[model samples]
Target: MSAPKIKCPTCTRVIEYSDQYPHRPFCSERCKLIDLGEWASEKHKIEGNSIYDDLLSDDLEQPD
Candidate 1:
């Protein structure tokens, strides 16, 4: 089992799997940093929701 070379999510730099390299999937630290920045800044938005809860609301009111 071994990691494969893939483009950096931020800079699209090809990264190979090896011991000589520390940050895999990224060409250099800068690329990794950029990716981190994207994550921190929330440039990507994933869509999903919990399947357990289907109810919109459960509010009950009584006249006083």
Candidate 2:
């Protein structure tokens, strides 16, 4: 059977999904790091209302 393939999340490069590709979905360490940087800078986020927003807003409305 042929190895499964996937596109790297950062560079969109096609790569084999196997032990040979240690980074798996990332293609390489550089691509993985770039993705990490994006997350750290808040460039990537899930589309949804965050549960923390309600908790924090409730705290702010109450007197400490």
Residue range 3-62, candidate 2, lDDT tens digits: 988999888999989999998788999999999999999999989878888777755667
| Stretches of model 2 off by over 4 angstroms after superposition | 56-64
Residue 27: error of model 2 in Å?
A: 0.7
TM-score of every candidate relative to the true structure: 0.57, 0.78
User: Please, what is the whole-model Cα lDDT of each candidate in the order they appear?
Assistant: 0.69, 0.89
lDDT of 1 by residue, 1-64 (tens): 6767777666776766776567776777887888788878988656665344434333435457
Clashes of 1: 0
RMSD of each: 6.0, 3.5
Relative to the true structure, candidate 1 reaches a TM of: 0.57
| lDDT for predicted candidate 1 compared with the true structure | 0.69
Q: Which ten residues in a row have the lowest lDDT in candidate 2?
A: 55-64
